[model samples]
Target: MIKRYSKSMKKRDILVIAPQPFFIERGTPIAIDLLVRNLDNFGYSIDILAMPIGVSPNYDRIKIHRSLNYLNAKELKPGFTLKKIILEVGMVIKFITLMSKCNYRVVHAVEESIFWALLFRPVYKYLLVYDMDSSLVEQMVNRFRWLKSIENRLESIESYVCLKSDAVIAVCNSLADKAAKAGSKNIHLLTDVANLREQANIECKEDLNEISQNNKIALYVGNLEAYQGVTLLYEAARLLQQDKVEICIIIIGGSESDVQYYQNKVNGDGLKNLKFLGSRPVGMLEHYLMQADILLSPRIEGSNTPMKVFNYMASARPIIATDLNTHSQILNNERALLVPPSSVAFVNGIKKIIENEDYAQRLGSAAKEYVFREHGIDQFRRRLQIAYDTLK
Candidate 1:
């Protein structure tokens, strides 16, 4: 018989320090949701101390605690900003207060919040688990070139925290490798699974009509952050129009501001084939996926796989992603088309997929089968169980 996490400690309680929103229709929060639910299944109670900016999870065995939001921030803007830093400070304070009241058996910190866990480990001495979502050092330096001046210092801090943590749960293989290189005592790989649940809101008014008889609908989902490389899609679409291949690019989710920003760019540039439908209920993602002829992941930064790729794979829609490690780790020439991170290369990829319908369908079918068999919720739960057992 296998050991159970609930029996490892007297309290069977965990303090989860999630630096992001508590409940959001995004990448990290969704992963956190699965963890919380699975821990509940294993008879563990969780107290989640999160940023005061999202909907409460309101689970049975979980209590949601929000940091003091002096700014009354309703929603945080994407990327690292002054606001995010202020929120981090607030989370640190709240974490300290929570720890002082009750002694949790485990302190599970996600992403950058691992810093606070490391700082307070000596005082509390709880089993510390670092949930490595992405390389914060890489994100900071890539988004802000000036951070390059102190990149080594940042890496040192990250490595030091990894070394101190009891266990590091990496979201991808690349992150697990980084953890090992940083001298982490224990490392576990737990990747995000596809969210394929469909919603009842089917009456979405999308202008995805193939204007010409030869038009194909290529859908892209997720925030329109600069790192997402949304502009690359535009550049590729412009080139495709020049070549007279009408690939109508339908962007499904993003902030209102990001939607306007990209919409303005497309409008001014006279790129008639691109459409932005703003943010949608993630449940409606399956509906859009079913309607899409091709899926696109054009992220230009970060090695961690985009959460949307799993959804794309489950949708049975052929994916065309950048040839970077971000997609290479999950995709290849066999399951999907991998092109260099260039507009010209994406233009060629789109043409090839559209020209040969049989090849595109084969790629989609293989991707769907692979993900369902190897990356389903059961696999996530098993991996998470094995990771938590390390604490014993």
Candidate 2:
């Protein structure tokens, strides 16, 4: 473990409390990585307190500290579960302990971590930054129907976190608007950039070769949550199977159990065109996307855009995404084929892309140009620095 409390320090320390495991190749963690790097570049000493569930990467300007282990589990996936609740409690205890020991200029809290920061605000003389990724209250209610009874309580907490924090850093414009409506005094819209370009050099694995050989391959990259529209993808695959147009649907990234569950469904349905490549290295994302004829974002519900969308756009692949606000904000009819959140609409969108090569080429080119022009990593860095400057 890296040293948590150092006696001497030249720069002002910024305490970052991440509710999830740090250094993981997920959306939130990846955003945290870029934030830490940029803050370090601007000369702020960062101390991150995260769950003891991820491998820490080396950062010159930041130190990663994990909470005390309370559960036998070591990995915490995205979304709410019993394991996540236990780990969150452990994180709260560790965060309080760290705040008691160190003097910080700012407290950068992500997701539920803002609640702990709020609790410590009375004693600590530091500015609070709520890194708003999504509405926690909405997420909880959406994930568990049982939690609907206590939604007002969750919303109250969320409102308090947003209103009380010195500033709110939103991942997308939708989140920024939500923060504004919640009475946040200052809101910074810091959108995410693509990581696909950086991951382009990794060599492709052998299992992917067969899928690449197909006449056309459609790729879906993300966790197989109910909200992600995995069922919709399967239904679309089944629909496409009837046509037998040599189009294969390849899914990448899912837990072992999720993969098995979906794999079983595919086998029972006898869908030969659907294949699952259970969780691969995140760095190989561009490698997989490069061989794809079309990329997919079949999310049925959400406000903030998925991190993969930016990479998909950057990949220069024709995208077939739902016509929800989450996707429509970044993608248009010229950049992607937007269909309603239904299997039939999704399949129709895919068919349109497959049948019209000229349309597909133009859409792909426009999408790549759009991402490169608007969502560059340099844009993220500049906006982040500007937000931090306001705190100073």
Model 1 lDDT tens row, 1-392 = 12323433234478888888768888888888888889878777777899989998668667888999978898886667889999989999998888878768888999988887888889987888999999999999988999999999999998888898989999898999989999886899888887586333456554456432347888899998889998899898888778778678888888888899888888999987888889887767787788889999999999799989998999999999999999998888888999999999888898899999999999999999998887888898898988887786
Report clashes for each candidate as comma-separated counts.
0, 0
CA lDDT of each candidate? 0.85, 0.84
| Model 2 agreement with the true structure over 3-99: per-residue lDDT tens digits | 2233244334688888887777788988888788887776667888888888898876578888877886757768888899888888888877777
Number of the predicted model whose lDDT against the real structure is largest: 1
Give per-residue lDDT, candidate 2, residue 182: 85
Tell me the spans in candidate 2 whose CA falls farther than 4 Å from its real position. 1-12, 150-153, 205-209
